[model samples]
Target: MSLNPLRLASKALIALFCLSVLTGSVRPTQLEVVRMQGEITMVTRNSPTTFYEDRSGPTGYELELAQAFADHLGVQLRVVVADSLSDIFRLIDTQPGVFAAASLTRTPQRERLVRFAEPYQQISEYVIYRRGGLKPATPADLLQGRLMVTAASSHSERLHDWQASNVPELSWSESPELEVADLLQMVAQGSLDFTLVDSNEYRMLQAYYPTLDIAFNAADQRDIAWAFGWSRDDSLHQAANDFFAHIKPQPLLANLAERYYGHLDKLDYVGARRFLRQADQKLDTYRPHFVDAAGEHGFDWRLLAAMGYQESHWNPRARSFTGVRGLMMLTLNTAKELGVKNRLDPVQSIHGGSLYLSRLRDRLSDVPEPDRTWLALAAYNVGFGHLTDARKITAQMGGNPDLWLDVKEALPLLSQKRYYRHTRHGYARGQEPVDYVQNIRRYYDVLVWNDEQTQPLKGEELLASSAITVVPPLL
Candidate 1:
């Protein structure tokens, strides 16, 4: 088949045209499906800022923000959770209608690989090490320890930039196999002397590992945004810009960020350190009851413990001035209704509270869970009548009745004469429950992070359904 080069090229072009005509196929540009198919696939990177499975399926700022864009387009949302950042790049490259919600930072190298939307968040990089370990007070201080970072993360990139331009003293190893959370765990375990993580990442993990501390800022104010594959058409990118603008004024972005990071940093180091110590010192005696009750009621034992802490700080003999008493802090009427002979007994209190929360949760079967769990917690604080009143207000005010996010804002309005006047339940200390639920949620997050369950849930699957595993770091 050795013919003239021009003749061979002409024949190949002719064949390509013929094949396209026969198949009736036209390749769409990146993210063009929103125009033709009215939908887009969201690529989730399984991280706190990007995507992580929660007790209520996938819940993260990335997932929620992506959902908002999908809703705006009047299209169906198809979620694809990427295994890693590399997987995200590959998917975005080969697939149309796919965009990344990985909270990816805009970097010069990445800009060549993919286009980024307008920045939604600004974060700083930090030098992290265990609390009592070597403190890197300055750039010179970094030389005193074994430094490591996740291979592809922005932390490593920052180090590389420093190495190139300014600080020849800057040095660190990279862990190819570790996720950012696993890196945080490694530092907490003292496997690595120090590592670099973003400030938000450091703050979020500090709630879990109170022993980890920030030595100094590595880099400040990097922009984080969504990433899409490079393409000639900019329809989806423009739409993303519009979406962010619309939500910014409505403060949706701030609300979503608050849901994840707001309650963090509320519990101080001593308070958190005390909680972990007590979990070791005291939780064993009550673990059996918590585990049993949690199983029967479909609640995490940590959740029940958080409730116990919020109510009585794990003191079975503790009593409130309102006459509520014990670890679960049951009122006399609640105790009588639950058939408790003695409200002061730790066993009875835990069981009764678990049962009560279970019953309340059952009432919300029509609603989505995790949010339902949150609503149930609020009902436990104020009566169901008041909770419903708040829900009604939320619905009337152009918000979701079933979403805890909306209902929480409306909850405090119940104390206002203008709002509560229309309700069956009269004025209540509305701010108390709002704070109550938030504080317990903080404790619950920490508990889930610090403890491993003794028993796996039988036949019942958690809403997240799957998890990521990390191998122990190589020294």
Candidate 2:
């Protein structure tokens, strides 16, 4: 009773600290909690742009980014897949998840509920419609058809803003059960009139849904960032910000973007349509041969198939003006070397091509995949000597010789005298391999998507497909 008021308050704080220590109730910082758990949980949506399983287990742009962050923290990554975009936000709000990395755009409405890390990407939203349909040339024309988007998505938020400010008549429905890919499919099938998709996503998926075309821009230049919960403890948030700052200047970020988004726009509407048609009408006849050869040579069957399509459009008797022929397009010397008796025979041609590609890949044992795979494919197309010349040029130009992105750039230089003059191989059609690899990657993507749609993963296999291994530090 006689103590000073400040003294009494200090005494109370000391008692509380002692009690907290005795009861084991001391609150740990978010970073400490994560360190104790030895794992960081990532909340994401299951989509091509977010998280999904491919032939090589779980791999997506977001998943890989999350993996890298987890590696930086020296912790394991635990992926939690949410059903919808709304579910992703709900999980981040309620759960102790580290962050949501599902390619979320930072909208004004979302900023009120959660804090966002540094913006990593910028994209535009486009109103998508099927070809041969009445295109909505302007925002006012959006009212002419049935438009829909994912519930709780930035696309819907954009629509709401448009409806409020300029076009009061612009209206659409929100589907909580479907994703952007589903909406695109609906538009292509004529079930829905139009939908909105981000430019990056539309580009990545356009080859699969060739009929869908961008009508107009719904929103432009939006920032995409990782979302964290708004809380008193912002240790994780600060750490994430630091992580981004460290990587922003490095090649790690650029390589990740190039890996996922660089080659997507290689095929146009007409080329995609033609590829799809041929894949449907002709690919089946040689599927068994591709499967057998790929299995024998340790390659994905779809990849082998894509290579065949790029080589000859899957024609058994395809002949190039330079004397390469057949489904895999083997020259006489290469065919003889690979023990291919008849280059026109589909089975023999596929086996020979697969073995040859595998041998080329093995030759570059020092190179890391998927760069190794891509380099091998380039060699398969432009000859190993020319590929070596390009790698030399890449190193000379101060680019990594192992990265496909750098090598592809240097490849075109081979056609020019100023660059190729000092090279072992003096002149080559360098641009051909660039286009060739891009075309195969696009075709392979379509095939993978088509296969997934027809046969999706389920149950135990789905659970086992998580990307858990820590990636080595980026160069």
Q: How do the predictions measure up, each by TM-score?
A: 0.78, 0.90
Best by lDDT: 2
Model 1 C-alpha lDDT per residue in residues 160-199, reported as the tens digit of each score:
7766665666667665546667667667766667878777
Candidate 1: stretches off by over 4 Å = 1-27, 34-39, 54-56, 71-83, 249-255, 359-369, 382-403, 406-429, 451-475
Query: How does residue 228 of candidate 1 score in lDDT?
Result: 85
Q: Give the lowest summed-lDDT range of ten residues in model 2.
A: 466-475
> What are the lDDT figures for the candidates, one per model?
0.79, 0.86
lDDT of 2 at 292: 94
> Candidate 2 lDDT, tens digit per residue, 267-337?
89899989989988988888888899989999999999999999999988999999998989999999999
Candidate 2: deviation at residue 187, Å? Answer: 0.5
How far does residue 230 in candidate 2 sit from its true spot (Å)?
0.5
Q: Lowest summed-lDDT stretch of 10 residues in model 1?
A: 457-466
